[model samples]
Target: MGYVLRVRMASFFAGAATASCIGLSVLYKDYKTPHESISLQAKAFHDSLDTRISTLESLRQSEAPQLPQTTTD
Candidate 1:
């Protein structure tokens, strides 16, 4: 009876450990998917923002007002 109880306890612990490992692996995999997607989205947004800033700079340069300069002798 003692031997049987020990074996049952060992089996139960082994099963629990296996389940925990699998759960952690699945969670890690799920975490990576969203992280990659968010990284890609952020990269795309940064690129578009850079393009917009460049365009706005060019427009500002072209439309800027020029002041007249006076010459002194």
Candidate 2:
């Protein structure tokens, strides 16, 4: 009876260790970030280009001169 109890305990601990390892592997895979990092970099580049185009358009509008008014008395 004592030998049977010891064998049971060993099997229980081994199963627990295997479960813990599987849980850790799943957590590590879920928390990975490579694709998110690349997406953020691309978004930043697009925003910079948009700002540059807006600034150029604003400067052009400001530099253009207005035509003089003609007299029709």
The local distance difference test score of each candidate is 0.99, 0.92
Maximum-TM-score candidate: 1
Residue 30 lDDT, candidate 2, scale 0-100 = 69
**Model 2 CA lDDT for position 37:** 78
lDDT of 2: 0.92
Once fitted onto the true fold, the runs of candidate 2 whose alpha carbons sit more than 4 angstroms away are 33-73
Displacement of residue 22 (Cα, Å) in model 1 is 0.6
Q: Which structure among the candidates has the greatest lDDT? A: 1
lDDT of 1 by residue, 1-73 (tens): 9999999999999999999999999999999999999999999999999999999999999999988989999
> Over all chains combined, what TM-score does candidate 2 have?
0.48
Give the clashing pairs for model 1: none
Per-candidate RMSD vs. true structure? Answer: 1.6, 4.9
